[model samples]
Target: MPQIVCPACGAINRIPPGKPAETARCGKCREPLFQGRPADLDGAGLARHITRDSIPLVVDFWADWCGPCKMMAPEFVKAAQALEPLVRFAKLDTEAAPEAAAAHGIRSIPTMMVFRNGREVARQSGAMPAGQIVQWLRDAVLALGS
Candidate 1:
């Protein structure tokens, strides 16, 4: 079984392998696990997601005031749409969740980090197009096996 942390109610749900994640709902909250959209998380929420989830997590640390962050928002959404079920996508507002940003040592806005098993496996800074974001995540996942 794969353990997934629910973004809505912060409950941990166990899902059987070979079952499509798109249709899997949280056992406690009844919310879809893979919504094909990035979940907006605060500091504590971010911590719980990263620490508890067994799947790969990609977090975009952004700030509202950043022009690049705003520009990349839609691209991130597109990427999330393409990458869900394989990767869990999340976003954190650096301005609102400074503690999470600082904990991750994010000095720049629009920083993306890939985490697996509560540890960072890859990181990329700056804004990118949706295709590039997807490719980057694919490469990161591939590298994890090497």
Candidate 2:
């Protein structure tokens, strides 16, 4: 079973293989696990998702005041729509979570990080189109196998 951490209530849910996780709900919160959209997470929520979830976690570190971040928002959403069930997408507002940003050593807005098993596996700075983001994630996942 794959363990998925619920973004809403931080509960861990076990999912059987070959099951469609897109329709799966959190056992504790009863919220849909995969909403086909990026989940907005605070610092603690980010930590929990990264560490607890069995699926790879892709986090977008951004700030509301950043023009590039705003421009990349829709692209990120599109990427999430294409990548869900294979990966989990999340967004953290750097302005709201300065400590988390600092902890991640994020000096630029619109930074993306891929985490598996609570550790960072890949990172990219700057905004990218949806296709590029999807490609980047696919490449990263491939690299993990190597």
Candidate 3:
């Protein structure tokens, strides 16, 4: 069983094999497991998603004042929409959670990191188009054999 931490209530959930995750609801809060968009994360939320999600987690570390970050926002949403239920998408506002950014050694905005089993496997910086983002993650996840 794959364990997924609920983006809504932060409850760890396990979906039984053969269950369709797109229509699955959280066992605790009953919120849909995959919302087809990035879940906004603060420090604790980032930690939860990084450490608890069984699926590959793609986190965009960005801020309000960053132009590239803003440009990548919709592209990220498109990637999320296309990849959900297979990969979990999230966003961490570096402005709101400076501690988290510092902890991760984020020296620049628009840094994207992919995590699997609580460990970071790949990272990229700067903005990219939706197609590139989706392809990057697909290749990364494929390389990880996840």
Candidate 4:
């Protein structure tokens, strides 16, 4: 069995083998495990997702005051819409979670990091369109051989 961290409540849910995780629900919160959009994360939520999620995670580090971050928000959501279930998309506000941002060494707004098995494997800093994000994430993940 594999464990997935619920996007709704940060609860760890074991996924049975040969089951479709997209249709799975969190036992603790009874919420659908895979929502078709990026989930917003605070410091604790970011930590939980990074440490506990079984699937690959793409986190966008952004701040409210950042113009590029605002511009890329919809594109990020579009990428999430196309990549959910197999990959998890999340956003961490640097303004609100400064410590988390610093810990991750986020030097720029709208930076993205891809994590697998509790470690960062890929990182890119920029604001790109949905198509580019999806392709970049897909290539990075495929290269990981997961």
Q: Best-fitting candidate, measured by TM-score? A: 3
Q: TM-score each candidate.
A: 0.95, 0.95, 0.97, 0.96
Candidate 3, residues 1-146, lDDT tens digits: the string is 99998998899999999999999999999999999999988899989988889899999999999999999999999999999988999999999999999998899989999989998888999999999999999888856676
* Local accuracy of candidate 4 as per-residue lDDT tens digits, 12-49: 99989898988999999999998888999998998899
Overall local distance difference test of candidate 4: 0.91
TM-score: model 4 vs. ground truth = 0.96
Model 1 lDDT per residue over 1-146, tens place: 78888889989999886888889999998999888899999999999999998889999999889999999999999999997877889999999989889999999888999989889999999999999999998887745641
Superpose all Cα atoms of candidate 2 onto the true structure and report the RMSD in Å to 1 decimal: 1.4
**Preferred candidate (TM-score higher): 2 or 3:** 3
Q: Indicate which candidate wins on lDDT.
A: 3
* C-alpha lDDT score of every prediction, in listed order: 0.90, 0.91, 0.92, 0.91
Checking candidate 1 for backbone clashes, the offending pairs are: none
- Residue pairs whose backbone atoms clash in candidate 3: none
